[model samples]
Target: MWELQEVPGRSKILIHTANYSADVQGCIGIGSNLAPGGWWVTQSRKAMQQLRELLPPEFDLTITHYVPEYP
Candidate 1:
């Protein structure tokens, strides 16, 4: 799911997250305050912490943090 996104000025990598609560799945977007393009993803808090560590020390991001969007 993470590898699907392709945007310019963005890094070429993927991250995955899971949320199976027998109800719904959650997702969030993130970015680098250190980079130009913000990051986009769906992941757990621990996963988020992993991202924070993986990302540069000055990156910024946005997260849905709770509910996943459905279309």
Candidate 2:
């Protein structure tokens, strides 16, 4: 498990594998794609394994939130 650092007013935030959004609590979940209706993620274990192999032991991360425009 990887803990996030320098998050304001938050502690113990980790990046881990979770099959669904409901499986996580205030932490980042790793997955390959979003399930139908975007309620949760899929292929979490595979994604996590790929991440483990691709990423270094420690590194900097940046997260950005994007909202889709619907007509």
Candidate 3:
């Protein structure tokens, strides 16, 4: 499973497991799956590792929703 951590900055965002956009909840989710349900991914840890490697020592992440919200 992917772990979500809060990064301090303009906003506190999450870094976690999400294969599809629907799985996201104001937090980031990374997974191999291109579809929805359970945020299931083949290699979750490896994906997280790759992300860590690609980013700088310290970085800020922002997550935005593609869908519209209704109150």
List ranges where model 3 is wrong by over 4 Å: 1-13, 17-27, 35-39, 68-71
Best by TM-score: 2
TM-score of 2: 0.86
lDDT score, residue 14, model 2? 95
1-71 per-residue lDDT for model 1 (tens digits): 24424444555444444333322233323322322343332345466577766677444444344776969
Give the Å shift of residue 65 in candidate 1: 22
**lDDT tens digits, residues 1-71, model 2?**
68899988999899999977677899999999889887788998999899999999899999888899999
Cα lDDT of model 1 overall?
0.43
Name the better of 1 and 3 by TM-score.
3
Per-residue C-alpha lDDT of model 3 across residues 1-71, encoded as one tens digit per residue? 33335544525455665555566666567654444445355555567778777877665555565986859
Ranking of models by lDDT: 2, 3, 1
Question: Candidate 3: TM-score?
Answer: 0.44
Error of 2 at 22 (Å): 1.8
Q: Cα deviation in Å at residue 50, candidate 3?
A: 0.7
lDDT of each: 0.43, 0.89, 0.58
Worst 10 residues of 3 by lDDT: 1-10
